[model samples]
Target chain A: MKQFFIFVKKEFFHIWRDRRTLLILFGMPIMQVMIFGFALTNEVKNSKIGILDLSKDEATAKLSERISASQYFDLVENLKSSSDIDASFRKGDTKMVIIFPEHFRESLLHSNSVQVQLIADASDPNTATTLINYASAIINDYQDELMGETKLPYTITTQTRMLYNPQQKGAYNFVPGVMAMILMLVCTMMTSIAIVKEKETGTMEVLLVSPLKPIMVILAKAVPYLLLSIVNIISILLLSVYVLDVPIAGSLALLMFTSILFIITSLSLGLLISSFTASQQTAMLISLMGLFMPTLLFSGFMFPIENMPIPMQVISNLVPAKWYYYIVKSVMIKGLGIEAIWREVLILTGMTVFLLTVSIKKYNVRLA
Target chain B: MTDEKVITAKALTKKFADFIAVNAISFEVSKGEIFGFLGANGAGKTTAMRMLCGLSLPTSGEATVAGFDVYKESEKIKKNIGYMSQKFSLYEDLTVKENMRFYGGIYGLTEKRIKEKSQQVLADLHMEAEQNKLVKSLPLGWKQKLAFSVAIFHEPAIVFLDEPTGGVDPVTRREFWEMIYQAAQNGTTVFVTTHYMDEAEYCNRVSIMVDGRIEALDTPTNLKKQFNTASMDEVFLQLARKAVRQAD
Candidate 1:
């Protein structure tokens, strides 16, 4: 253990001496949180929404068809009943579910008006509001098309219901996203590169010639990165609270516990990558392409996992970042406790164990 | 040479899948002897040294280092041996003193011993004033010397040097040999590999390997007389000319 602490101290020196690593560890997290939170929050494209047409009328069909035809929305599901709308929203496949009242076309013809309820999952309020505006515009276009045919003017009213977050001040989505991204970058990418640098420089062989165990070498290497990631998490949280005006609505202890778990998971991934490649460049490229890309694309952060096809959704479950993002969203944004995110925590723990076992086994085989 | 043996190998071998890296070669070195391991490129000198240093496993061999078995007691062997590779293994980002302290700590030295010995080592290298400087700022010869010093800082029984003086100037190489001679004089067995036959003259006994087998083993003067040559270079060339394996 004395040796382990020495190894850990040496690792700190390596990181402290390199300015680029310091830049990535401290500078990038604040940049991502502030930039994505304040500046890049208003992008909505290819939103997959569900249609619950209670009327099943010609007007409802025409309106649903018009909404689907627009480039901004992809009609993923035809939700059967009112009950299924909650399931679709919880599954996150549907951003907004449009419900049409019964006899909409007949009511419009007889009464000259109809109510179309737009239930948007306001977990991400920016996307939710933008999608509602797009749907309302499509309905207005349909109303004008009807007015062109008939001499009388028809009216379509849209009642927008923002679910789960009616008056929330802590519903910023980028906090969790930036956390996942920065952890993966600092823990996974930097740790892998550091280990591979030893191999490339041949210091690893020299250390192996000593009395130090291989597991101890890596465990010591991982501790510094783990601490560095915690520093990064603190910075991101501070920026989100002060600059972005987002509050942590749940237990701070639980938030930190989950972040540390995710950090360990990322470090295990780094050890696995280091075992596969010898050169620093190859390790870095593998971490970027194999780990970072998948985390960014599948973590339900920048892009919705439900918007992807079925196979991609299955693959997303294998990424530890996906589960971490879910847990952070539950605790940070939804103000839910462990009861709401126990399964996600369990999955992250399982991924960390599996990665650590495989990487250690491979490292031993190489040395043996 | 002393009667006590520090290293002994009998039919030691290492095979990687279909390729035989180091086939059934054996030798023994007594304590306090400078043993030279000579080979051309791809001749398995490094591979054999790796197995003995516990950095790699021998496919089939009966070897002991410092009275510890190479197979089951490899970790014990590691504790008693120090190694420096062709690539300089010191942490270039660390200061000269920090590198020494770290190596000393990993070797299970006490805190007072680490501090005192590191200071002593710095003074011995005439680098006390430069102890706080990062290793990267030093010249190549100083870096090489510091790496060699760090390897044996804990005074292990046997120090393995794998081409430790591959690319230094002649003066620096002479100084490096002086360090090796001093270590051996202090009763630390030196097992080194190099292609420079001139450096081979400094070893008490030398073994020349070609294509995974030791082709010759003797004192440098005996090798010259046996090959009917005046210099150790001609003796090595006469034996290495019959090789078929290409340099890796």
Candidate 2:
């Protein structure tokens, strides 16, 4: 509509005129991608590795306990059989699958040796290799302790099998996380603050009193943000692929489609925050505290969700950013298709719809 | 013209939970009269105006603006009315011309009409040379005038001004009243709410609200005579002291 265009044009003027906004919109995404991609991480903590204990003996039980107890890895899934490891790896749920052969205690006592196979989901080669080394060292320590006491000779072997990411580039992990964080900051935080600024300046009343419908006003406000978020996505993708050398394994179209859903989810969240806040300062604080902290702490962008406490893992389910991070990981790093990520897409879409509905209901044309 | 009422209300009310913001009250305004809405800080002047402007729903009662029902035909009412708030509502980041262009565009003004009207308004304000300047750079008086002009740019049947001259000098306020008088002379009804008692003298009729109800409604001369006061200020003080609710 002509009125919608006029509203959008006015919004553009507001955004363009503010230098701080221009800096935040364009500067922050690139800086976040480059800084997080190249600089932040090397130590792997809370790697989700599955454990399959074929021998229900004291030794394997002790081994599982010690592996999980170690600071480096969190034993996320306990597999029933060898058949489940491949599916778990493809799901990107588990980084490594440690399997103990049947009759390991008997075989170790009878032949002085036992075989243990370590299957690493090489999608993140760095993490996979580190997990294998940690597991191997733990086993060697246990074997050495046995040798220290008894005169009998015994040996344990660790076989490492790497999966999707053969190169173990650290950029793989950082790329997905940076994308999620930057999109969330730009879309959610920025939109909330912008809308609240109108409320602060008292221009929102004038807008509401205009002939333009409230829904149309909200749509026009969101359009510029949607376009800006897309631009941010493209810029992050370029930096990740070209500068950081992170590969895009899946279809770029599908990646973009998923990003659009995530952006909408974030925008709805921002609108919801704006509706609750009376001023720009309150909106900014709530967005940073509500969105930024949770996305950073619980979304598995900075830390693995499986490694978090049970309550935290449950809470992370409510954050749209967690699902977006998983989707990015599956499509970009694991090279998985839509069939593998349909549930995440559904969740993001559902969150978007729910947030948008609540915000629309909450957005009052009347001044409080 | 007095027989042709533009705004008619009967027992209009608004309640927020247990608290009644605007208790049952009613009044009527002529088609081209300047109606001054005066009240203490928490006297519910804004609440009543909000309901009438189609921005809020009343808990009970019926009202019509510009011949359209306030409840069901709010969109129609919106198209026929204009509003300006206490905080001057111009986009400070935008140039003077752009602000006019934007308001004109949203009010359904055609491109040529917008250009011509923008020019005419700028010339009328003697601000044609300052059209390209950002509104924030202008003085408070100019911003207030520009905001008022934009509100009635569409020539709505009624224009509601909420404390339009709050922080301006007396000379500017006088000039601003001249503009309102000119608009009313051209057959545009003005419904304005202000804290300043002197501005009430400029209105054709004035209503003073106290504690969610209109305590007095009459011409400024009659209000002064009835209260046994020499000035509108003394008359306001005598009525305002009876307020049951504290200023919010």
Q: Could you give candidate 1's per-residue lDDT for residues B56-131 as a string of tens digits?
A: 8899979999999989999899999999999989999999989998999999999999998888888888998899
Model 2 Cα lDDT, one tens digit per residue, A1-368: 99899989988898899998899889988988867665523345677888888888988998899999987788898899988888988887677889999998889888999999988876655567767778899999999988888977889887767777554433337788888888888888888888888889998899899988888887888889999989989999998889877789998999999999999999999999988899888888888888899998877766667667799889999999899999999999889999999999999999999999999988753333
DockQ leader: 1
Best by lDDT: 1
Candidate 2: stretches off by over 4 Å: A40-172, A364-368
Candidate 2 local lDDT, B20-80, one digit each (tens): 9899879999988999999899999999999999999989999999999999989899999
Candidate 1 docking class: medium
Q: How big is the RMSD of model 2? A: 10.6
Q: Please report the candidate that would top TM-score against the real structure.
A: 1
List pairs with backbone clashes in candidate 1: none
Give TM-scores for every candidate, taking all chains together and pairing residue i with residue i: 0.81, 0.81
The window of 10 residues in a row where model 1 chain B has the poorest summed lDDT is: B238-247
